[model samples]
Target chain A: MTARLRVVSGLLILAATVPFASWWEAGLVRHVLGHVPLLVAAGALLAPRGGRPVGQPTAIAAVLVAAFCIAFWMIPRWLDAAVNSPAVDAAKMASLVLLAGVPVGWAWPRLAPLARGFVLAQLASMFGILGAVWLAAPVRLCNNYLVDEQTVLGRIALAVAVAMVVAGLVAALAGPGITRARPAA
Target chain B: MRSGGLALVAAVVAAGAGLLWWGTEGLSVFTAETARREAVALAPRVLPDITLQDEAGATITLDALRGKVVLADFIYTRCPTICTVQGSDFEQARAAIRAAGLGDDIALVSISFDPEHDGPEELAFYASRFGGADDIWHFARAPSRADTGALLRAAEVIVLPDGIGGFIHNSAIHVIDPQGRLVRILDDDAWREALVLAQALADDTAAAAPVAGGAGT
Candidate 1:
């Protein structure tokens, strides 16, 4: 798809998620997993083509920042706060969609095969771990969410983890042409 | 440069493992002790000696229960959610205490937030359904809506309209010391701790009193 189309699609999703942001399940689906990747798609499309490839240091910083932002939102306290406080919720939506996604999109294409795989693997591991925890926890972690809702979220996390793994494997076995020859700086 | 990048990747992996451990433990790093302390810290400066009416329309105050350790919880008779689970937990705790013969020293009270609906009759019905006894497990209500609101605020219980004219509130058990001081609000998971703490508080009060010297003094 064209860059403009990707941006438009991202914008459409951002708009669609606003209504469901108040609900816990919708918040996870639309904001955490949905808009995050959609916004990344837009960012990748909009990335400047004329510039030299993003350096290793900058790529690392981008991934780190994106990872941290995503991880912070995954926290039960932050998730509860977002549900209780409108300002915090808005911050969650904005930071995840804008701050996390754009940098990841810009840096991902510039990263080496090993670094890319590492990032994907990290996300997959996180989902799997958190999924297992939420599913197995006997007590409710979030004050606003019910035990059943938490379990449903755990299932979603596991499903996402599996999908991430499958996607990573597919990319790894795509072809020899998938490999980047440039040495990562 | 590539090696440094790989090292960074290694660091991220290590961090991921650490985080995974923490998450799998259900944020266990924030121990139950910490939750107890924080909940206690959030109580109001002074627990008001507010009047509460039992299901039979009998008026009682916190001061009346001062000599005993009170385990309090907020609930509405019509609540179809967490209150049920909380009530069940309270039942188990009650049984545990009674089985240990600590029933007289520790009193369990469920304060209704919906005073408009959960009047004496409704509360009585709820108490009966939940197997609450008038002498042991008392179901009470605030004398007025305003009083109920104040009590809810003082207890740090957040109540919101569920859009169906019902309310959503925290599931917690407030522990009041023998001195009538609001001490800790144990989370639902801490029911076992509540029994232990209540017993301890009662024992402390009993231990502090000079039974023989009272008449001479």
Candidate 2:
């Protein structure tokens, strides 16, 4: 790719991330934080050149999960009043998964072999944390709080699931691209 | 090389899930469903002009209900609690008055606070459910929000709902004479006062009109 092409590609990658950034601000911080690695990994795929850090297969698998998340997240916004409406308990849960997944698809090129193992580990750990939280605490739902099904704990568990899935998808998709882009020198 | 990255991901996932769950388990909801049954005091003054609504969607001014005993209550059907309770109370009172052979001379009107959604059909349903919903019970619905607001203010009775959906306000039945003037208010009357007021108002109308004195006289 030419210098100009690289720049354009970088821009396309960045533009795709704008919605994620905006959503993060509008009550999606949990999803964003949970899956930050996948987003960074995808950015590395089309923009910067980051060599594989570890188990690339794990991260790559995470990328596919991320893509699925992005597709699902768009569903709610699409169904509403062309912009905003129909905010239900179900929509909130769906958003958590999407926020975590999109970054993996977008940044696959950056995450090499280590992505798969990393994602699996993250998901495993998350489950433990969520079960503990549920067992230890009492839950409540209110109108203002937009977390998963209106529970703080549910939101956390969702965020963890999304992050792991996104990471795996990214590493799986970005490996080949990263290998091909190796310097001619 | 990616060992640190994997560890970071795991740590975050674990911590976030754990903390959020713990927080949720501690949450409790607060609910309120209380409503005031007693009437609020108000000073006497010339009744405000209100273009009351009739059952047929026609505009009937307050003056129209005059020259007879007018019994009015503020109600809304969506009101899952208070309106139903008050309405049922009003209906029982109406039944009692009728059983006493005093239905002809008195008029019962129920004006809805939620004018936008509660129309003729909704009002009719509420009336019909408890019976005595025909000509004698005028289920009035305001044409607009402004009209409802004015009516609430004019009656010196305000009903507001709490966040939990229960209404909070005074429940005083009004006694309006045929002159379109408020003759008196039955404080916290519910149904009992309603029956007495309806009967007394009927007698007032009879005494005022010499033509109806044939049977009662």
Candidate 3:
């Protein structure tokens, strides 16, 4: 599709959807998009035109994390909470739809296994550090990290952000290697 | 690739970005900080499996709390906001215990998350606020941050303060059986009714063992 069309579709979606969560009133699109849009921008910048295609783009990590997020993290949580919380269950659908729309960098060659492993390990490390620090800190300190005892739910949004950043950086870095021979018209 | 397809993908991404921005702003509106739970769904979050320093500076393991129904709440005297609400709620719970006359059987403990600010003296003041029996009503502050955090997390009641005197936290009172196992969460948004429920539970428990026959059977 033409760049113009890509831009327009992206804008139209912005107009059509007002993101909402399940449990409570109102929408949360603005709060999250500040960080999410970077992924889209990264993907669009890394779109390959010709030649061997760069194997990795920063957006690759983002898409991978987002995809994994939908599968492992988000689904179980939604299902678990859906049983007891209408608000959360409702928000789950809205979150899925919105998350589904995030763009891609369209890397052609694909990442080396090392890069993929790095991304995964990085997230685990982040979580580990957060958890460790959280354990050592005061209970009041955790109020910033979470609102309640259910660490799984309270930490989801942050986990998503970290995953995106890690993946987005990978996608961005991949641009140089794959784009050497080809250029999008 | 089809221009339309690429465009479709971009559209999706952009839309996601928009939604994310909206969700963040809207989500925090009534966050726990601003809005409190109307009716608490009290889950029995077990207390940290550690020995704690009592008001007397004695090592009182939760095991030591056995043989008595224990009522536990977390607080820091320095707090001016929700701590006050929580403290008041706790005091009310204690009063309710007294009113119900389960004073001897039930033990009310106000553990402080801020051990530094809530040492024995501060807890004494906090206990003083109620002006009741000091024997059953005891306030203990952890000696270290890790211990305090563990206890608070285990209790599922975290203490967060707004830069100023205001505090933010979850107020779910726990009732433990004589064995120290957390049995029930008190849902007295207003301590007035909570004590009644606590008393009823204690009475139920007391009567349950007696009603069931023993060795002779």
* lDDT winner: 1
TM-score of structure candidate 3: 0.50
Fraction of true contacts retained by every candidate, in order, equals 0.05, 0.02, 0.05
Flag the better candidate by lDDT, 1 or 3.
1
lDDT of 2 by residue, B108-209 (tens): 788777777777777767767777366567887777788777776666554544446655455557777666666566644456765666567667667767
Q: What does candidate 3 score in Cα RMSD to the true structure?
A: 15.3
Off by over 4 Å in 2: A1-185, B1-44, B187-189, B208-217
Task: Single out the weakest 10-residue window by summed lDDT for candidate 2 chain B.
Answer: B29-38
Top candidate on TM-score is 1
Model 2: number of clashes?
A: 46
Q: TM-score (chain B) for model 2?
A: 0.67
Tens digits of per-residue lDDT for model 3, A18-66: 2422222111222223323433343344344444543244345445435
Measured by DockQ, the strongest candidate is 1
* Residue B30 shift from truth in candidate 2, angstroms: 29
Tell me the interface RMSD of every candidate, in Å: 5.0, 11.5, 8.1
What lDDT tens digits, residue by residue, belong to model 3 across residues B1-217?
3555445446645655554434333344223222222112334345666766666666666777666778777667776656677766767666666776778778877777777766666666766766632767777877888887787655545455543665556565667766566766654354655465556666777777666655544
TM-scores for all candidates: the values are: 0.68, 0.40, 0.50
DockQ of each: 0.22, 0.05, 0.06
